[model samples]
Target: SQSSVDNMSCPSTPSTPTSPIPYEIQIATEDDRESILNFLQTFFFRDEPLNSYLGIITEETPRCLDLENFSLKELNNGVNLKAVYNGKIIGVSLNGILERGWLGKDDPYKHGDTKFGIILDLLERVARESDPFKKYPDCEKAMTVKILSVDGTYRGKGIAKALMAKTRELAKEHGCGFMSVDCTSHFTACALKNLGFELHYSLKYVDHKVNGEVVLNPAPPHVAVTVYTQKID
Candidate 1:
């Protein structure tokens, strides 16, 4: 799933060009933590649909510690990757391994009243209902993209796609049988679809409610949270 607004690019496969895109996809390690966090603050924290709708980062509160923690919790995982151009991080894919009963095992939400917690609660619901593990019985484990985002200035140039492509390779190396992403934005869904991921589940904002109140009311086009998966052959 994407927590970044740059998914608006929804790029197609890169065509032959006069020169290369000037970026390289590389494994992200603990050393890159600060840079990745800075990149995310600029590219992801403010405009992602849920963050925007919930006002997770606002003028009064410029940062959300919980969200920051959630984003970086798996940063050191060998599967996480970043796209760097001119020595600057332009995109990142924070991935983690999920074993066969992950849905029923992990608790993704703890601070239910906090905006970040609320967002995680919704995602947990989506995962529980989708149950990707059950759908792909042969997949003993899978690599899940927790956060996928790209710098706005570098989008529409296939940076996000390149990051995902690299993530797929990393998944295979880690022995994952499948890979999945939850698309929190329509643009992200379109991007994943272009990369051949199958939509396994979706929940429209209008249909999700809390105490009879619709919790999310993002602008048009980002109307649903969707789960997409691809077997790693």
Candidate 2:
């Protein structure tokens, strides 16, 4: 039942069902940026399919720069969600609102390098072409789940599923008609699908042509960028 959304891709993870863990969800504040980014450095950059292909977490690279830039950009001056357990931040969903035609135009901020630029370009294209809000042209608001990261210590405890559940409520608070995510992690797309997010479009890495070549040759099961969405209630 796992399906791709649009462009952001994720590597499929082997299902390991586990009981849900206890945690509390809340909207994030500016002060929490440092802690959330730190957690992502350990889990996302090292594990995110596209980031790994771009050498984002390589020792030779500046620490957390790529991850921070990508995730933080979606902050949109704040409206993020976090999962706390015993006073520690175990998960995050960096969010933003995508107005109609937001993707039909160019991104003002230029990506740092060819690697980043190419990936962003690919995703942007699909987002505009296969916009989840296309059918509901009057639906001006689309809540964007820009980045979702969970702590390694909390993995397999259903932390991600819990966070996504809260995200729905948060989207409603933001007055969004639907929630959207460009899931680059394969497991994430599958999990969202299970949570009832509909897969809209997908672009496989091998098929994403760059000068007629497949530059992002990520490892197995990390095949394509998937976009998923669901109406918020």
Task: List the candidate 2 regions with Cα displacement exceeding 4 Å.
Answer: 1-22, 62-66, 74-78
Off by over 4 Å in 1: 1-19, 106-109
C-alpha TM-score for every candidate:
0.90, 0.85
Candidate 2: count the clashes: 13
The C-alpha RMSD in Å for every predicted model, in order, reads 4.2, 3.7
Q: Ten-residue segment with the worst summed lDDT in candidate 1?
A: 1-10
Best by TM-score: 1
Total clashing residue pairs per candidate? 1, 13
The 10-residue segment of model 2 with minimum total lDDT is 1-10
**Model 2, 145: alpha-carbon shift in Å?**
0.5
**Per-residue lDDT tens digits of candidate 2, residues 1-233?**
23333333444455875667668888787788788877777777678888788776787774755446767765535568889988888888888877877765666645636566666767776686678888556677888888888888777787777777777776687678998888766778777876777887677777777678786768766677778888765
Model 1, span 1-233: residue lDDT tens: 33343343455544753244779999999999999999989988897999998999999999888899888997777889999999999999999999887756756547888888878878878988887888789889899998899988776787888888888998898889988888888777888888888878888887889889988879977878889899999
